[model samples]
Target: MGSNFFHHPNGWVGTTPWWKDAVFYQVYPASFKDSNGDGWGDIPGLISKIDYLHQLGVDVVWLSPMFESPQKDMGYDISDYQAVYARYGTLEDVDQLIEACHSRGMKLILDLVVNHTSDEHPWFKESRSSKTNPKRDWYIWKPPRYDSDGNRMPPTNWRGYFAGSTWTWDEQTQEYYLNLYGPFQPDLNWENAECRAAIYEVAMRFWLDRGIDGFRIDTVNKYSKRTDFPDAPVTCPGVPDQPAPEMWCNGPRIHEFIHEMQAQVLAPYKAVSVGELSNTPLPKQVLPYVSAAARELDMVFEFSMIRLGTGNLFHGKYMYTPFPLSVLKRHVATWQTFIEGTDGWHTVFCENHDNGRAVSRFGDDSTPELWEASAKTIALWQATLTGTLFLYQGQEIGMRNMPASWGVEEYKDVESLGFYNEAVESGDEKRVQAILHGLRILARDHSRVPFQWDDSPNAGFTGEGVTPWMRVHDQYRELNAANQLGDPESVLGFYRKALGLRKEHRDIFVHGAFKLLAPQDESLFMYVKESGEQVGLGADGNRKKALVVMNFTSRVQRCPAISGALGCRKGDERLLVSTLRSGLARGRVEELRPWEGRVYLNFQP
Candidate 1:
């Protein structure tokens, strides 16, 4: 009956909790909807869309940062932790959004941006005023390095996240401040006890007191920076300019800080925290942050899958190559297997506000016909995974990447603008084309487009003649939610149907076992999800069992390990959901086309 045990693969009991089964729909408040005729989406607009999410089979709404910010990084640069952004309405509007979610029997979690704070934030302002100030220790600060010649230099050879040195020189204090992100966003000093305590209060007495469920902590692993401030090794081969990921991530004090925060606040409120762990490459590195025994966080989202496109962090978004299926299988299977017996859980996601569209990244979205099929295929893959499903806004209708024709005017993300200038400075037209093309495929601005509610002008996100913060995707006229609401073949309709399976067979989809099938094959991606021997959580006495096969390529491919994965012949399984047309037969796949995904139920060994 304890929450720390679950049904292990060896036919014994293991612990799985309610958080393991939660399905989160991640929404960017600036792009979700606009109730008023204002150009920007607001809390009231999100409140107006409760029924839409409820119908999409959502269990929780993980709204992105709405906390008071200067909009430098689109709210990641929080100016005030306790207050809502003026553009997003008041705290009452947030309460209304929360109440609406609760009324629809859904949970809501705010985005916690505690890793860093905006330079405009009062804490940062005071901390930057004087070196000896009491609050000066609240942020990472160190004297600049001086050589024998008295030449000033950064404290370390560290660069983080975006383009620039990690250390920001402050004129007022005559000291260099550490920032793993934008210059305006200074990294917090977790080493300070008062800083940690104050953050705990913000999470507990300030936000949690308002009756919200939990937080999705952004840049969680960056909480503790390597203390020595030494020169970092290069993260990727041939990318000597970029500092190693270890230089500023997964440092010594991460677990200690997380556990202390949990003990002081999270446990008391019984609320959950899912941390966004960037640059952590291994499961062991990931385990401590989310292990139930550690009592740190409920879960952590490791960026292994999403990084497949660029291969590594240093490669950045400029390297646009088709994600090799071979590498994707290895990364996924390794993490899935390592976390199987542990209390740590995985945060399953294909796309989010920080990345490109799922249908475009992993699916074939070059044309209209391929877009719908590939989108549904990805949706099916997302829902059937064995962890908390995080569905980004517009993911249901298969939103594609931004158009290649759009220039810097259409782009809002700082990364895109930075990369654009860097490319132009190279004096190569081909390089410029490549950089822009890559942005269309990988920039965060692509996902920040206004959500398409209908086929009306402005896509029903805002009224006529109002300019949104970012441009809407051009395809919204044909692929809007209104068009897909009833059509069974539409991408939205497909998601609704596939999500129903999670309710019908919770054990298999939620707290089930995940095993990668045909890990060596480079074309078709296959896997199996099965429940433990005991009767799963539902009223039925049967345990969960299913086989999922997907073709990542445009070419037809057979199920390479049909017998090995399911322990049964092809005819023995029943097809429940498929992105393509028709039933499968024989050992070889029956007409498995490009970008096709299929799930089999009633499958037994």
Candidate 2:
């Protein structure tokens, strides 16, 4: 309904930059591709796939950790600060990745995991070498409790993010070091100025000088903890056993640390930051990090929306539960309202490395017939929302979740395996069942399955002769980029169109004010993105407007036309995009088929 290029009233809506306008595609290096016959994906593999990304219409690529590590947490636990992982190639391979991306007019960013390092890291090795070692203070270490008796407990009642006690005793040094995650991954002490400065160098100077664009800050909210080092408070009302990460998440001085990092590094390079803030639901806890005045981060990712719909009776995140459409509506609407016209910004993503496949989690991907419609419906929603669109690799092809019959042995994620062992030790079959179901639905492995590039053996991800790092999802034949790339009705083709529309209509999709139009209906998630008064025909091309009505259920819904609800004339609404054959008519009446989404426009040239 407008020109090929749409500009905001000003150069941008409100000092917005390319970060807010670009379409993001996340790549998990271990599974994206294998350049060498080694089965594991490397930087050169990513470089080889750059043209595929450009052809798919993505402008920004966010890679998961590719640094040197023990693979305990899939590279999340850093062993070396400046070198790339041996399996993922060398430092020169990383340089080639940056250059290749820039040549294609795209930006590449690495995952910044500074909150903790692998126990094998030189800093931790020396820190645990002896209590008096100069590097001992680099990590959070304390003496065991009950000094009077030989037997003792951990310093506090804190819990690890993966499972068991957060404190691990070091045989070399009598003191216990805090490890909020896996046993091999110890938390770094940000209060120590030296530790802070060194992490700053890793996050700022080193990579920035290497020609990389920016970072997706990992566990950004957990960088600081209370000086008193008290026990973490329980999060749920009755679930006392749950890890109380609330004590460290959004801690007292986290903002200060981020502000310093931003001032020292980000400002100079004009780089962007998208912080992954987890384990909290309060908007107040997250807003400060992304507020422009706060100078902490450019964008903040809150998990409440994804959390509220997942989990079983045991916890809120790990277990599986059908996502209620009404809950998602409320959660997303709250975020959209909070960041409107403010210095802060929002991020839209249905799945990441930590989450499950969107088509399987939120949409109905139980059968072959439901796959295409379901994936397109959710992908369109993410692309049109008023924020940056983060699309995980293989999402464009509607990759399904792990096989239903597969056992936990098929999973490689440290958190999933660790928690499963804990449940098995408790001798609680019910708890074990919940954990297994949760792993199938919400585990990190669900998204970690190899990216399906084609129909070859191993889905064209790794060499046929080599074994992939993780098992590829079994349904790669029916759903893969090579098969769906040209089919207009295929999920991959739909994604290309959605991404193109987002780029062409940035003003309407990225800057236009968002309003939830049909909040009362649990079966529908309907909203509008418009900027100016809804006048009659012949409006200026600068007036960006789009009305999106989505049926999130599996059954056909009798959706009444809301021309009035969207402040448009009966005939002004013109269907621009739809997953169903029967698109929206010019009037106030209609029905949406299962998992159908329709976008309407105001004026057409």
Candidate 3:
């Protein structure tokens, strides 16, 4: 595998990087743990959990934003890039946490949010103070345009990501400022050289100087924008302005700015960066950012898989229909095959701070019996894939979406609240109900609930008398981590076993050739991994193959024979791992139980 190289378009050859073999775990600091009983998780609380992460076989820890802010967008709007929020800990606490992770053979990366800043940030405040202020060019500002009737209008017909017009009028300056997200979070002007340098100093250099590993850059592809700011074409009816992702996402100067960042800080520290490419999913557009020859980013988180069953316009991610399993298989196959032996890399994940739980969205979670089996099957499926695997905090314990009985007030996410309020103000009762139902299943708040550690009050996230920042899941009493620590068949236990198997057979699982079997089968997801012919493993004089079969349905399904495909006798196959505790055949699996998965090692041909 070491001799294999991917040729680039510029006539360069590249080898694998360190991040390809690592497993990343994302920690949303505000909901992870609370050390002072303040109803919020802190850096000190995270420091106490390093041993838990190390035992789970995690190689890198990706922490969400904990920077100083007003909590409007839950730390995404940064007021001070260098200072940590008081509710979370101090800069000194972050230093201690970094040391703790390194002492245990782990690396830590921070969330870099440079696309925008809090309206209260000193830079933005000065920029908004007056048109002639020295920092006025730090943010995007435009003169107000008027109609023939003398009514004031925004510069362009573009909608904010949350809601309403993208350009907000500032009373003090008498000019409008661009805010792609909520009004409180103003977008920065990357076209200005001084603004770009200042952002690099605080957002990247300051953190790397503290001995951190790298960054999970938020909206990395949104750094540049079309200078003209043309009006977006109308897409949704009854809405004056429409979403213009094409105008700003992957703009003309995006690659130039990213390459500058790579040369300035990331390369010097030998850091690893996984960027969030908003609204860019095509392999042609995504390869330039992650290809080794580009020297831009190590990998990127694509949204094609997560946007499977989501809604658009008025619905806003609230789904009314079930996501088809056959469509998901095709999406997975497209990405896996496109970058099989290329210079580009991929990120494999099912849940994150922005999406619903994995088991509830992709697998069966209606019953306790099926929930455990389905969660284990999902774990096995992720482990056998060829990329960097990222597991959200509560995903290992089989967490599900919030209950539908809860009121809309229980959700604290800005996006969810905006969608609900807009539907209510329209005087549409049926639309309001449908939006509420969608929020229950697809809201970001479901992943932001406090982590369930034990059966105690507040799910062991806070003191018995203190109320949590968000409501704990109603099933914490039965699905807490303490009960699963001792049960070998628990979802958390199964995740550990599956990850261990990947590490043990890195040659076959990480560097092997991938082939999808039964592409049209909706109930079964079967694939093969071979190490010798494709990845230059034959030089070692040992060739190996692994067969992975998963049942993605609630009902029993027939399993296909694998002896011919693997070039091995029927009795020579060895079962490496199985999600079922019993009733699994030894050599050839004739049938698979509901939500079952199995991995077999076939003897060399």
Choose the strongest candidate by lDDT: 3
Ten contiguous residues minimizing lDDT sum, candidate 3: 1-10
- TM-score, cand. 3: 0.94
Q: Please write out the lDDT profile of model 1 over residues 231-285, one tens digit for every residue.
A: 8765555433466568668888888888888888888888878898887787888
Tens-place lDDT per residue, model 3, 246-283, is 87899999999999998898998888999998688688
RMSD of each: 3.9, 3.7, 4.0
Please report how far candidate 3 places residue 166 from its true position, in Å: 1.0
Q: In model 1, how large is the Cα lDDT of residue 516?
A: 85
Candidate 2 Cα misplacement greater than 4 A, ranges: 1-15, 147-150, 233-242, 312-316, 532-544, 581-589
In each prediction, how many residue pairs overlap at the backbone (N, C-alpha, C within less than 3 A)?
A: 6, 0, 0
The lDDT values for all models are 0.80, 0.80, 0.86
Leading candidate by TM-score = 3
TM-scores for all candidates: the values are: 0.92, 0.93, 0.94
In model 2, the worst 10-residue window by lDDT is 1-10
Residue 265, model 1, lDDT? 84
Q: Please state the error at residue 13 of candidate 3 in Å.
A: 18
Better candidate by TM-score, 1 or 2: 2
Cα deviation of 189, candidate 3, in Å: 0.5
